[model samples]
Target: MITNLIKTFIELFGDSNEEICTFFAPGRVNLIGEHTDYNGGHVLPCALEIGTYALVRKTANPFIRFYSKNFPETGIITVSYDDLSYQEQHGWANYPKGIIAAFQQLCPIETGLDILYYGTIPNGAGLSSSASIELVTAVMLNELFAQHIDMLELVKMSQKVENEYVGVNCGIMDQFAVGMGKRNHAMLLNCQTLEYRYLPVSMNDCSIVIANTNKKRGLADSAYNERRAACEAALAKLQKHINIASLGDLTSEQLEEYKHLLSPLEQKRARHAVTENERTLEAAAALEKGDLARFGELMKQSHISLRDDYEVTGTELDTLVEAAWKHEGTIGARMTGAGFGGCTVNIVKDESIPSFIEQVGKEYAGKIGYEASFYVVKIGDGAREIAEAKEMSV
Candidate 1:
């Protein structure tokens, strides 16, 4: 991936591109719990090497011209600093335009940009590509204007654009992880308080292998909202019997104490979230102590709850997890992102990753007949300045 970036960077800079700054934001991979983010629960996620890069230069004209390498198309949108709106002709540009809108809210803005974006992260693969784009754009604008916004603040602004403008009710996990992830570590984030720490990720002999299910998540569909609403209902019902505000606060025993107040199905969903949050905390500690086996056990249990209790895992996702478990030298496997089909996160022995990929792909192909896309991702630094170029001369 770094070699490919070096090739593209040389190409982009070799041409007459003016003075440019390329901002990057990483795609995140959750190590453990799935669908536990928005419920005010704990999730272990790290920034991926796969990320979005926005190559931009200051423009003389009031208009901003946008080009996408993925789409290989050009879009020219004229924006008035007086009032910024293109009448909702939303596309790849909206991700950047939303950042401009946020800048305008705080103070007077000076300039627009001519942006050429080339991204490698798979779209709709539960890898948070959209968040990567939004966060990187925000970082670009910040450096360009010297806005000096803090890290978490930038994460919130990026999230707001996705939620209010782009329309996705995602939690802070993706944005936060990408915005603040440390190299060689996973973030132990407390969603309720917005405080986080980098938990040491000991992948000395293991590889974090991701298998994309080739299925897209229909988050706007009923399933996503249904689970969210179920958690809310459980909180409301449990509040009468317990003093807790959210399921995040309730103990495992406490959750069971008020189980009778909820429908059998809702209780199961709520139970999974409460326990999963606990597992994430324990898993973080296990990783810190270099106890991979204990952490692996937590990941395996996470998949079971997501499948049986949360009811998010589909047959393909389940099959992928099962295949990884059966493969020797695999520590743990679970479905990542908001289920209904996305990717499975697996921790496999570094030497065995190749065989595990081949075997899993071959067996899954026979069962599902669809080829799975594998991504071997590692923890990378969060968003920051690209001070010195990577020696662009050929």
Candidate 2:
């Protein structure tokens, strides 16, 4: 695939003498924690083997030219470094442009480049494709400009691009997982403190299967911001009655005691944040002890909280998860990303994967009247430049 991408880049930009380098950043799937990132809570997420790839070469021009094999209709979208503001007409190009604008704040970007991106992650699947783009661009620039910035700082800068430039009120989970992911491990992140530790993913007989609902969700235009705003308001009300910094700071018992301080909607939102944070911590403990059954139970409870308290999962997500629960070999299943409609992360026994996919796909189609896609993915490393041989395997 890298060979073909290189050929395409050369064909479009002419045979330039500059050396071309390739980079990769993987997409992420949250295992248990949902709608808790911006609430200053804990989250569990892992990077997938499938993500966005970039083939780039430096140029003397003052403008950056962007192309994507995923969206051929857009062709090559060029942007001058002077004008990096968001533009609706630019479509997907805004993501990369946002990162460039962010990097310009740290160092001077004097020369431009030609970049070709090919992503395996499905668009609107809520797998952090946008963050994948942001991190990949940030890593590429870090290499090109020889800016020896710390990886954690790059993660923060990528989150800034999402919040300030892309206009999404997202938390640090996605960017952090994309930038700091380790192979065969899931990160336990404290969003408020930015402290994290990787827990080994040692499901010896189980595999991680991602099932895409095929229902498109636009995050910037979705109710994601409204939920964040609701949580913020709830935290403010709780502060007046108690001494706490965020929803994550409160326990379930404390939240029940102070539940009257917030409105009905605020109470539910706060409850989800507080309880979900606790569940994430417990889930991590369960995994640490190699108790898959306990982890699966926590995962089921997490989905119920997200569906009832958070009110983010719609019919599609609920249907898929409910279907998965019917399978006896299923260990756990839940909507992975910021709900509405996206994919679900499930742990199924190796021998049951085939039957799980067939039955789940049939049930989903019968109810939702459309086919869903499934992929058995392995946990992968974080963003970086890919070597030629490694690129072939990726």
Candidate 3:
């Protein structure tokens, strides 16, 4: 894939071999936590082996050119550094454009760039593809221009690009996991405080299988913002009676005690946030204790909360999880993202992955009238340039 991308880059724009640089940024999957980041709750997310790649070179002109293999119909998008505003016609390039716009605020980009992007992540599958692209752009710029921005600062800038530029109110978990991921490990992040620690992921005989429902979701167009609003309203109601900054600050018991303060919908939203936060912490501990069963049970509980309280899991996602539950080799399965429709992260015995995929895929297609995709992914390192490799061969 790297060689092909490099070849494509040369084909698109005449390349100066020495000036070319390659970078990768991985997509993230939240193991347990869902819709908890903006609520100031905990999230356990790990970077997937699949993500976005960029082959870029500095250009003499102020005009930036972009291309993506995944969206060939869009052709090459050209924009000037002076005009980095979002352009609907540019399609997915807006993600990188948003990052460029945000980065320019901190420091001037004296030179324009020609970039070729290719992503392995399934777009709109609740994997952090947008964030993956954003971080890749940030890291590419940081390396190419010698901008010595800290990684954490770059993570924040990526989030800012999504929130302020792209107009999607996202939390730091996606960007943080993509930027700071370590191999074979998951990050336990405090969304409110930004305090995090890496927990080793010892799946042993089990594998992390991501099953895509193939139901695309546009976060901004979905009920994602509404959910955030509901949580905010619930927090406001709780604040009237108790002193708490966010839903994360309260224990499950505390939330139950104050349940009467909020409307029924708001109460359910708050309960998911509070309980999911607690579950995330416990899940981390369970992993540390090498208790996969406990962790799997927490994953099941998370799906129920998301379905009943959060209401993000629709029929497609529920079908996949339900099918997974009926499989004997499956340890746990749950919708991993903001939910309306995306992928479910499942822990299954390595030997049973084939049967698990066949059975689940059959069940899902039978119910949904469409096929779903499955990937057995590995935990990988964060975004960085490839110094030794000339091309990326996915």
Better of 1 and 3 by TM-score: 3
Show model 2 residue runs off by greater than 4 Å. Answer: 389-394
RMSD of 3: 1.7
User: Per-residue CA lDDT of candidate 3, range 1-394, in tens?
Assistant: 6777778888899756456788999999999889899999999999988999998888787789999999989998999887899888787999999998887887899887889999999989999999999999999989887889999999999998899888899889999999999999999999999999999999979999999999988988999889999999999989999998899999999999989889999999999999999999999999999999999999999999999999999999999999999999999999988888989999999999999999999999999999999999999999898875543422
**Which tens-of-lDDT digit does each residue in 1-394 have in candidate 1?**
4345545644543444456666788889999856667777778899987788877777665766666667644444455666656345656677777777887788766665667676778877888888888888888888888878898899999888877876767788889988997898898887777777888787768989999988866555538777888888888988887787678787898877779999988899899989999999899888988998898899999999999999999888998999999999799899988888889999999999889999999888889878889988888988765655433422
The 0-to-1 C-alpha lDDT of every candidate, in the order given, reads: 0.80, 0.92, 0.92
lDDT of 2 at 190: 91
Alpha carbon deviation, residue 207, candidate 1 (Å): 1.1
Which pairs in model 1 have colliding backbones? none
Clashing pairs in 3: 1-393, 2-392, 2-393
Count of clashes in candidate 2: 0
Q: Candidate 1's C-alpha lDDT?
A: 0.80
Candidate scoring better on lDDT of 1 and 2: 2
